[model samples]
Target: MEKKVTLPKHKFHIQAGDTVVVIGGNSKGLRGVVKEVIVEKDRARVEGVAMITKHMKPTASNPQGSLVKTEGSVHISNLMVIDPATGEPTRTGRKVNEKGKLQRFSKKTGNFIPDAYRKQ
Candidate 1:
């Protein structure tokens, strides 16, 4: 048998809990926090952004089927990270920060982008 090789993992531009704006699709111009990132599909689920309805079958909890509402996945390319400093959507870039570690920064304003999840 031949040896199998694995490719490098993809680095997502966005992560969980990052505030983002939907630049396209039905939720265009809407802002929400990133709930989760679906790396396999390059999609991100944003809270209060892509509202989808699902028809559920009857279960022990209920005799009749019910409709479930939840956030839907949006393509990563359609989402833009909001710059905390500028309060505007801006492209992100990775650069070495003061701690000598790679950090995401706002390309438009040259400011370090703080990790929204680290504070808490």
Candidate 2:
């Protein structure tokens, strides 16, 4: 008998440092850079995307319990890549520039991602 191997599905195409816009959920229309990508869970944490307040229980670390506000992870399906030039959400595609450098650009804005963090 032959053994069959199954692989998991990966949905989100965006990677860390990529600016994305929230397309669905409670935080719809919000734009932020991807801080982390949880590929196994099909979720990505976007900087300043999902904000939630939690009550922390005091422990040895802190004698006082307090309310904390933190960013929450969003499903990859809810996010769309944002164009660096126009600041609008768009699909990402790679192409070689005049200098033969590989560059990613927004299909909607027709502009390449900023050079500062484009390497990632």
Candidate 3:
């Protein structure tokens, strides 16, 4: 029998509820909150970017068949995390804080993001 080994999922600096800006694609320059992050696929679903329309038949939820609008997953490479301190898009880095806790910080301005801004 052959044994299969699974690789660990990729880690991302972006997290849910983080404010992000689309740097490329049709939604370029648009800002939205991170609804979900797919670490394995390196994609994220933003609140208002990459809108797509889907046609669905009538179901229990929808009495009538209609077009539903939704946001599609955006590639991580095309998205940039917005720095709360600078109000600009910047790369993120992880560091150990003075209390010996892992914290996310902006590489651009070297500002550490407070816990209040991150989603628990």
Query: After superposition on all CA atoms, what RMSD does each candidate show versus the true structure?
Result: 1.7, 3.7, 2.4
Residue lDDT tens for model 2, 1-120: 999987866534587888788999999988888898998888989888798899999988888988998888999889998776776788877888878987777788667665445554
Q: Lowest lDDT 10-mer window, candidate 3? A: 111-120
If the candidates were sorted by their TM-score against the true structure, best first, what order would they fall in? 1, 3, 2
Q: Let me know the TM-score candidate 1 reaches against the reference structure.
A: 0.90
Residue 105 in candidate 1, Cα distance off native in Å: 0.1
Error of 1 at 2 (Å): 5.8
Model 2: lDDT of residue 2: 90
- Identify the candidate with maximal TM-score: 1
Clashing residue pairs, backbone N/CA/C < 3 A, model 3: none
lDDT (C-alpha) at residue 61 in model 3: 91
Using lDDT as the yardstick, the better of models 1 and 2 is 1
At residue 88, give the lDDT of candidate 2.
73
TM-score of each: 0.90, 0.70, 0.84
